[model samples]
Target: MDRVLSADEIRWIHDFLELKDITYYDVQVEIVDHLASLIEAKWAAGSRQSFEVLFFEVFKDFGDHQWRQLLGAKQKGVWRQVVRNGVSIFLNFFTWPLVAYTFLSFLLIYTFLLAVPNAVNYLQESMYLWGFIVLVTWGYVIYRRPAKRAFLAYDGFVTFLGIDLYLVGWILPDFFAIFSERFSATPNGMLGLAAFYSLLVLVILTFSILMRIKGVQQFYKTYPQLLITQ
Candidate 1:
């Protein structure tokens, strides 16, 4: 007499495929149902065959090589979707807020620097020195942990901050003119100070850009199949 498979047995097979990672969850369920129906039809012939024997026969006909190819294709599709979703969610959560915060930070720092009459004063000079140190430290951190999510957030923060500093430095002349008029400094001195500030901004921007580019390249190299595996 024909042997029959219970619904629970079908579910078990599906779970097995999932646990083995032989197929994705959705595909595993579908494949299990289809195979079970095929087995049922075969067993309805009234031949006394065991479930294991019937299953392997049906499975072998699926063509091991072809099934592997199909699984590989499905894995690629799933991984791409995973990576795309992760990046989309990350950008949604952090992009705009980071940009706004970085812009405000740049404005506050530049305002303080402009307000200080003596740039050479210990406090003023220390601020500039610490700012430079922070930028370099961020660049190094990104370089070391290129593939981490934290690194991506840090890079975005630094890039926007650098752009803000660059813009403020470019417009320093207008602010310098007002300050010089009140303080009685020559335009030459104001121009010299602005040039130095612009140069520092440029250096920071360049370093940030270079570090970001290199870090991205390294991330891809380290996880070449990260997108496909996700």
Candidate 2:
């Protein structure tokens, strides 16, 4: 029987991947397991190769790109997952009991803006307020959260979620100000497609944050190390 890899050896593999910038925990873990299995198999084949020798051989199999392909694969997968999760969240609001509340919320927003003497002015200001609020709240959450498992959030989905929110919050008002000034007079230019897309992005970011928080339980079930019990 071949000798199994030690804990330190596994961590070495992780560090190697990290050095290659494969920092996402999910991607790192997957690749580590794969390399371990290959290394052990090589060892069992009576090859007198050291860990470094075999590690290089395995890594080289993925071409000169190192871990970039794997990293890209994980990023792409996470993006797809984020999109799917967003769609599900979007649909949930328009279905069954929540639909009524969603409608009421829409109506309230519509009424509040329509009732204002200068609706566009209020909107421009409100976008800034909303952006500021989003930036502070999410920036605080990300700043305070322990980083031991930050890699777990590195799947790119949650990271991008927070990033998009922070950016949207910081930039939306400026965007609205510019767009409303230049294009508001045009027949179809109430809010450009860009602003409309930004609205959908905000919705995705909001739901993505919620998913990541609620997702902690699911992840913790699989990776108990994620839970920082104090």
Candidate 3:
């Protein structure tokens, strides 16, 4: 029979990882599995060393600088997943039945601009409001589910949302203002610009909502215990 780590030994591994500051469950889990495999392999090879000795022997492969490099690499990978998920979610709005709703939303905004004299001002205000909402949503997530922060995926998603806050709240509005100004001299131009901005804001807000909800749900589904405790 192959020697496997006992439950206590695995718990010890978790503790060691936390002590080493690899506390994110999403990242720690992979390292734990790899370390477990290496330790078991040593035991199977007829090494008489204790678990601590075997662990240090294997960990020595990752010197302090190497460990930091590994951590940075893992973080970059997690953030890349965040970007991929965001792109996928953004693309879904343009496909199938969702595309119908998307067009309807654009048309409705266009019509609304045509009907209201001050709709452009309202639209700008709404963009700022949505920016505030994004910040609040991000803050709520941090406050309500601090445990989720222990996940690299969740952390990456939250950071992505923060970047989005700056883009939607500041960059988008400035761009919309400049774009509207350039086209205001043409017929139906302001209305068209406002409508486009509105649709864009809608799409971005939807993307942010879906990203946060999906990310949180997936993490909880995978590790329900995190929810039960914190």
Candidate 4:
């Protein structure tokens, strides 16, 4: 029979990971599982080496610099997954059953833009509101995120939020004056364009907020031990 690691032995693996600076909680989960499997395999093979010895022996097989390289690669892969997930979720809003929400949002924005005295200014204000929503959503995520335990996916998603802020808060506001002057003579045109842009901003902001919430739920679900009251 293959002997499984004792609770203390399992904890030793965790401590080893931390000692190696693999601090991201989610990343540690994968490496810990892999290390456990390797250690158990040696036991099954009739190796009587102690747990600590087997741990290092297995780690040693990865070559002197290979373990760090492997960790770096995994961290990069996690960030890529984060971007792919956000894009997929954002695209879903424009498809199938969710498309109705997208349509209605556009209609409502167009209606409001038509009634407003200054469509451009209204659109700018709408962008600011969406930007604020993004910030508040980010704040909630930060509040709920475990202080001592970090997740690569969660950190990657927050980085996306920072880019969203740059676009909505800084980039859009700067070019608004130029665009507004060009469309000044065409209020109808301005209203349609503003409405479309507003809807786009709204959808992007919604994506950021949803990504943060879902990311938190997922990490917590997978690692309940890391759960903390917000």
TM-score of each: 0.36, 0.66, 0.76, 0.75
List clashing residue pairs in candidate 2: 131-169
Q: Which candidate would rank higher by TM-score, 1 or 4?
A: 4
By summed lDDT, which 10 consecutive residues of candidate 3 come out lowest?
221-230
lDDT of 1 by residue, 1-230 (tens): 45668877876776666565563444454477678888888879765677778888888888667666766776565455434544554355346765565455455544544665664243324435545654565566556553422222223333434543443334434444454445435545444444444444433443445444444554455444433422
Q: Which stretches of candidate 1 lie over 4 Å from their true place?
A: 1-4, 11-28, 44-48, 90-98, 105-230
Model 4 superposed RMSD (Cα): 3.7
lDDT of 1 at 28: 58
Q: Assess candidate 4 and give its TM-score to the true structure.
A: 0.75
Q: Among these predicted structures, which one has the highest TM-score? A: 3
Candidate 4, residue 41: lDDT? 93
Q: What pairs collide in candidate 4?
A: none
Model 2 weakest 10-residue run by lDDT: 193-202
- Report the candidate with higher lDDT, 1 versus 4: 4
RMSD of 3: 3.5
Query: Candidate 3, overall lDDT?
Result: 0.74
Candidate 2 per-residue C-alpha lDDT over 102-221 given as tens digits, one digit per residue, 9 for 90 to 100? 445445544544455555676666665656665665565565454564454434334545655654665655666776677655435543523442344345445555655544433445
Better of 1 and 3 by lDDT: 3
Best by lDDT: 3
**Candidate 1 lDDT (Cα, whole model)?**
0.52
Candidates' lDDT values, in order?
0.52, 0.61, 0.74, 0.71
